[model samples]
Target: MKKRSIIGLTMGGLMLIAALCTKAVTPTLRLSDTRPKIILGTAIPTKFGDWQEDASQVAAVVNPTTVAELNKIYAETLSRTYVNRQGNRIMLSIAYGTDQRDNLSVHFPEGCYGGQGFAVGQTSQVVLPTVAGGIATSRTVATLNSRVEPITYWVVVGDKAVPNSWEVKKVKLAYALQGMIPDATLMRVSSIGEDIEQGYQLQQSFIDQLLQSMPPDLRGHFSGTSH
Candidate 1:
């Protein structure tokens, strides 16, 4: 065969294989449908352990996502303030989307805070205590005016709790390559306080208590553990 003709044939074959692979791996099944319906209202308890949801402070907690973004990104978003007997309050926000395709995933707190004129600090890795030992997470501090907020959050890609944004994308792509679209959730817990260390400790304790209050399976669901 002529060299030009051979090169052209090779290119054509490669393009055909690429198209076939793309079609073969196109995700048509949502992993969420394989499980029971998710109802944020009941999936996360209103009152757990010594903490109870306080309606008054719920409004005080601001969601990082705006109304339009919230509607676009999440199928259900839950935001609440829980107060303990000691009057300590922690604001919990959860964003869950049944479909997390390549074009969309979840919003970052740093972006929202930056847009709102708040100074966001460097994020540090942390582990949230759970029955399965500990789940990897991230923490950062955001400040606006005199208010200081310390946040501890994690992103779950399907049944896996990813360590960072890069891992999130990797997991999503793996699922997509398997012809499955994975559901994802972003859970954030924060408290307004100047003492960042103390704030993190309190948040950790709250998470431990909250997880302990749920069933083992539910605990696994929240932490993305096999427990």
Candidate 2:
């Protein structure tokens, strides 16, 4: 009986120590935990070429008037996160009716290792493509990425509403930028480039097309104009 009791006590003690050690091994923050899914947001690993290309192409087709307006109206962005096996991170930022102040932005920062983030920093200027002197212009300030934890995103929307149904325009891009971050030289290029403003110009064009497609009656709602 004495020998059996000693064995039982030893087993119990070992089990308790093992449990405590297991708890200590667990990460404090578990940065590896998958980020929450957002309605209009998605994350893609860097290896996938189509991901960045598709996004840039979309931005190219849709044009916003000015860099400011482009930033405000439409931008699918990812920040502070590296690419996983899938593709570059992607998130859509759009206002429902015309509420700019209470906008929502999604961030996927979990998988970033290094050299992963917004292609253009806050200071960088992105000039959108343009056909000519066209639609109205407006500006709003917003952030797309943050260096801290939990990831951060800034989606800017103004009190602008779309009048008609959603209009999608597919414009052929002579050149387009893939991934959120561009190379060093591209970053320095002006929004009003010698011929084209890489990121800004293309996105602006689509914004204009989207606005024009809106039903003539609904146009006023997004422009913050009353007919």
Output the number of the lDDT-best candidate.
Answer: 1
Residue 186, model 1: Cα distance from true site in angstroms:
0.8
State in Å the error of residue 192, model 2: 17
Model 2 score (lDDT): 0.27
Compose the digit string of candidate 1's lDDT tens values, residues 1-227. Answer: 59999999999999999999989878999999998877888989989888999988888676776798789888999999999998889999988999998666887777777888989999988777765568889999999999999998888888888767888989888998889999988888999999999999999888988888888776777787752
TM-score of 2: 0.25
The residue-by-residue lDDT of candidate 2 on 132-221, one tens digit each, is 222233222222244221111111112121111111101001001111110000000011122222324433433444335444433333
- Which window of ten consecutive residues has the lowest lDDT sum in model 1? 218-227
Q: Please state the error at residue 46 of candidate 2 in Å.
A: 27
lDDT of prediction 1:
0.86
Candidate 2, which segments miss by more than 4 Å at Cα?
A: 1-92, 97-120, 123-196
The lDDT values for all models are 0.86, 0.27
